[model samples]
Target chain A: MALLHRRLERSYSARSQGPLAAHARTLAVDAAERLGRLQPGNDFSAPLMVAVAVDLAQANAGATARELLERTLRLEPDCEPALLALGFSLERAAEHQQAAATYGRLVELRPDHHEGRLRLALNLIRTGRRPEGEAGLRGLLGAGTPTWVATLAAQELVRLLIAEERLEDAGEAARAALLRTPGDQRQWILLASILHSQGRRPEVLEALRALPAASRGVAPRARYSEWPDLGAAASQSRLGELARGAESRLAAALVEIGR
Target chain B: MTVARCVPLLALALAAAAPAAGADIWVTITAPREGEYAIGEVEIAAEVVARAEVAEVEFALDGRVVGTLVQPPYRLRVDLGGQSIAHRLAVTARDAEGGQATAEVSTLPPPIAADFEVELRQLYVSVSRDGERVLDLNGADFTITDEGVEQPLVTFARGDIPFTAVLLIDASGSMFGDKIRAATAGAATFIAGMKALDQAQVLVFSDQLLVRTPITDAKEILAAGLGGTEARGGTALTDSLFVALQLLEERQGRRVVILLSDGIDTHSVVDMEQASALARTSSALVYWIRFARDADNPFDDGGVTMTSAWRSSQEYGRQIELLTRAVRESGGEIIPIRRADEIAPVFLRILDELRSQYVLGYYPDDRRGDGRWHRVRVKVDAPGAEARAPRGYVDD
Candidate 1:
């Protein structure tokens, strides 16, 4: 019975360690164990236990995932995924600085990993490190990352530019993304937005009018009935005497636009 | 003496007879019509009391001398034509003693007509994003599906397309600390992503909607209001969103909304359902960002209760999910970012999505105003490629 129970427990633990659940559980257990071990001054087993915790956490466990992640750092202090995961977890924990340091370590360990770089940039952005974040995204884009990575990088760059009120630069980035991928609806919208912001009415109109036939059909139509029409005497009549003369004419024009 | 006194008294009594009074002269001049006469010829009529004689009468237009008349209740006609616009006419009548009175009238035309129209073209959009999606769609990977259909492709060209975007920032008190900072940073990033031709309006809301600034450069606007913001009220996401939609409806070109919030609506007058409906009916697209905080904070002194914060955060997440669904239904996308810094990248991704859409145009076969809503559907002729369009257009 004891052996059966032990086997059942092992099986349960193993099942829990499956790819989907392992990371979270591992993190939780690792955190719990590391704290326990650290308090007792058990430094020797800390690294190994923490490493195991990281592995479990990466496999997608629960509280254990975070616990293991912290334990791994307490033990080895430089496991890349542990650091990265810790940083991400820290960010999740709202410990932006700590997360940033973890992300920085991950970047240092694997400079070529675009995901790592991206994560680092994101952390930097959270910490108000605009320049670093911008540079990281730009570098990733220039490095010919995957379409998704590049897209994200480009987006980040463009967003930063826009935040800085560098519309021209933002426009350039948008154009670059468009050039790379012509079917992106968001890019087109952003481009159109930049043009509109600059008071380029004709160009803006042209852009809107030029929406792909597929998307154009979805564009909402003006509700003429709900809108006031000064051009229509009956409709204008509802406005009373105030709808007469120059004031009426102006009101009518407004109605036309509203429509 | 007595006899003299009696005679005097009798004389006085006889002299107690009688007495009387007399009269004066007054004259008045009147014209047949109530208007100003010219300088050449004129007509003057007079009315006299007690047989008084009329000495003279004079007329003028705008204080300029016209003519003089001398007659007693007599008619004299004067004509001076060729006047520009209108003038004020005055007449004076004088008696022998020079006692005179005056009267005047004014002549003018009616008001003129003016012909004028107001042109408002703002932009609005719907947005969505997923953290797990590996395909970083450049401007090319997106297919806009409107109203459960596909549309043709047109205006597929690239560059800085002009538009006006509204940045709706959630300023609820619950989004304190890093959440607020992240939101601010994200807002700044969105602003920085715009082109010079594009304008953005920033609206920050909690229980009430506060328009921080009208459409302007994203960076400057963000910088001005990002600081000194304390997220301490209920979320009025729906109201702010509605305002954005209205603004976009009035603007020309591509319209969009970049909603930066935790997606919790503690104080929204309009619920998510209504907001979704409004989004569907609007031409604008919405990009919702749901910022999630870490759940491991042991110290419970962060103003908001942990359970409430978590609940609110989860609610925000749910709202974001709903918003994402709304964007998808309206041919837009919702982006979720775990970190505050991811805000900028998310915005950029939205932009990329905007550019990559397939624009298709076609003249519909039906042109009748039968007051019916027409459904539009587009499909890719290419193998393995899908297409989408808006649901329908109302013909009234």
Candidate 2:
């Protein structure tokens, strides 16, 4: 029986994606359930349950997912992934304070967990604790933080400032993010957007025209290369495609600008 | 012969002689698929199969009539009453042949934050040359394809065809004062420009519905829908857009959805793929008037940046990708603006573009309900002329 369970695990791992993945996972989950039924539950059951919960959520089986996550948390209170998933679920359900608390537990378990920090901060903002949330986001911009996390932090901070009607602060934050990762595509777009928001059209055009091209062979993301990075996406169905190099993107932006 | 044996033989003979197909009505509940957590209000959709023509579909919630729908894509919105208990939702489709099909979905309490899948759509198009609207195009002037297979035209119109639109305004917390006002003004302007023949509804949302106006051409009603709303919640752009698409599905003629958002969807349960799926299904023109940068893909450091909420950076990236595709696929475009002030003009300009458009549509030769992305391309026969239509539709 144990060998069978192991085989199920191996099979699921082998087909973790594609059409057969879900079937493989269902088999693994059923095996896991049978194993739990036959043997005393232990630490092994918690992670397995968490994985099952993730699958359930993906399949739109949210109630079951929530219940499984709850059971998993009860068994292993410090499960980071479980905590994160529960927090997100709560946030989605519009229980911001509860979501924050769940995220708080994850943060306590792993202080450096990037998502935990971001979501906790976000919930704080939703609950009207803007300053605290802003501070939390600012902390993610520390030098030791991962580039991706920090970049997101910068973007969120800029967006928060922009939302708060501090246009200059938002622009400064965008520039600061650019300074951190000068070659980042999105930050440049952010900076250009800020200038445009301040009603500086010529400057917006200048800034975009100077956008650094995608770095050597960086696999173009769907949006970065093909998705209209600039122009009116509202219906570009009728407009022309603007893509690839910097100039093309600028021309797209120009279309939106009515320049 | 024994009497019992003779009866069994007669019944078997009658059953064997009966036609094997299309004898019974089939109404299958297709949405709220898992019935696990249907948070907020969900659109109950059902697929009905019947040999007889469907007369009407009665949507009942907890055994009460929610609405009577008369068509394929039988759908109706049901509020979950903010309960965490189980509830029974059923749909009964009655057809012209007097056959009835009944489908029911029991949604237990603790519903999701937002999820409602309803119906599907086709295509809208516009052609331009040298920075000007190419007004003189005809059905013969364009060629089209679906999923790389060329399709013949089914319908063609080049004038100001009547349309129904949904002005999806984001009144999330970030849009508190000026931003919300500007978005409202823009939506109002669009409503004002609507011809008596053209009707639209205003759907304002921030995590949940702030305001929803009935589909109408009355400017006063439209203005009232836009009047005085506070932006104090999280952004549920995808969920709100799903609702917008649902509204468009029931309308005839060209359907349009003009979304005013910052591209950040924090509280939506629908996510991007589902929203895009609904867009393709509704075949409505989606105009995204964006105000901010594309939300960052958290996958900058492999998967380390993934949010625990399962909105992993990878997921977020995929979300952004699908959303961009949804916009393009809807034969609509995104108009990115920096400030609140530019919103009203953009809305008016979109109205003008709607008027200038040449709507063209075609049925794919071998595509119907296969649930696949059929890439579409439209080419203008005239030199220097270019055409734009949605990238494709999901014939699911």
Candidate 3:
């Protein structure tokens, strides 16, 4: 095995030896320190040090882990793993402000890094800076944002609006998600449910009708909003027919949730 | 090995020899990673090192026995199901000397399977007239209908039935300060009321399960577990409820889930519908002790009422609707109190009601496990005799 990787494995093995392993923490700390002192000539030194830091954090030596993370960051300021590990350790300790600052640094370093920005926005919300966090979420839902990140941002923004009693805005946000990510079907369920809650029957029917049709002859269960089959339920002939002819708009919207 | 190593080894030996004190068994779970969404056949592996000769390790799903391991690598693989739902795994280890120790871990609750059980259903019914409980009713005195079809009772028991309960206290960030203290006191009151034969587990959850004691009749142990908890997360009410049902699903006899919360769920992946389905599946009565957010306008509290619906998040309306409906369908009641002080009294009152309730079980005539909601109605024949039972059940 490679020398650094072998040391890493041995360090972990020492920690998990048993309850009687009194030197487990000390051994782990020593291993991390030794790895940190490794010459910078080895290309894997930085990443390996970051891994040892994460292992230290998991072993409950978080303070020592932070020290190692700092050393890694000093050597490689743009180290993504080191930043994320440090931020996550802080977040786990409920130090949301510190975590947010760490994430902010990562975001500044890599503006287009979707995960970094997402973590930053989440930490901002956790630190009680709701308005800025809400704005951050909104900014991520633009044209270039990945589908996963946009979906998450949309969910968070709508949740915030809903918490603040801005139901109409939440509905709009859900609709915005549908628009931003074209051909995305999941948002349609979210949009229909939001509209159904607001009693927007026409729009509810329109959203449900817009759902993708691919299935054959599946029936609609009475309760659709209860989280029906995921994906497009429009293929269910009964659902489409119900959406068109059902007297109750809420009933019609629920019918297509068979997806 | 140095003397430093020998000291820890000696301590482990001592800890292992301490049998009756329950200090010998040390269990640390290594699998079913907490934050990861686990589905299909998830492995439940734990590193258990005991002082005594390790006899066997038993793993349970909810309270149901899943599997037992007699050797090293104390692990068992469990099928959580096709859909991701909140699953609580209880692992109990028994040494050769008869010493036993147990620990519990819960999977991150996910959106559940939309189905119900077709087995024998137990309904915990409480009858009252003029705000007084009429506890002397028999099986002959009551008539039950499933989907409007009259069904014969398979098992009927009145009072004296020992019940297992899970007291769910919401220790969210909003529940900080006096709210948490009141909740703790209330939980203590419920634990104090449990009979020596009755078993209960206290689950204090915010975004995570902060305190979870095993099902025990020891009041001091239950009360001690209630202390030192800091309220600091969003309320995961639905997920917590689903966890409660999972914890109670395997326990025999009558089961009760008493929830104390001041707000709608803000951090749960498991929605109310899935929780509702699980409630019906388990047949455990769910009592929600809601502390009113607004004293003056009760309807404006928790965004549950129709008047309050337009104000809060759209999802809250459905959550409150489904949550309240699910509680009622489990034949349990919701008590809303404006003051934090009313918490203990409400908890005591629910405990009293549980002691006086009647349990009826029946095999549904509709044998087909058609995943449809059934309308169930229970009636009493005597004059002014009001019977409170589940409104219906979902026959999955």
Per residue, candidate 2 scores C-alpha lDDT tens digits across A92-198 of 55567888999899899899887679779878887888999999999998788866567666766776786687989888888887888787554555565566457
Number of clashes in every candidate structure? 143, 31, 4
Model 1 in CAPRI terms: which quality?
incorrect
Which candidate wins on DockQ?
2
Per-candidate alpha-carbon RMSD to the true structure:
34.2, 30.0, 28.7
Question: What DockQ do you compute for every candidate structure?
Answer: 0.01, 0.02, 0.01
Q: Which segments of candidate 2 are over 4 A away from where they belong?
A: A1-259, B1-122, B293-314
Residue B209's lDDT within candidate 3 is: 54
- Tens-place lDDT per residue, model 1, A1-259, is 1122222334566776444343443443444354545565443233334434444444444256567566556655655545655665555445556767877887787888676687678668767998988888889776468665675566567767766789899889988977785654434545665665566756654554443311221111111001111123432243233224435576678899999
Off by over 4 Å in 1: A1-259, B1-156, B217-219, B293-322, B355-358, B364-396
| Prediction 1: B-chain TM-score | 0.52
Better of 1 and 3 by lDDT: 3
Judge candidate 1 against the unseen true structure and give its global Cα lDDT, from 0 to 1: 0.52
Query: On residues B194-216, what C-alpha lDDT tens digit does candidate 3 reach at each position?
Result: 86557898888775456778788
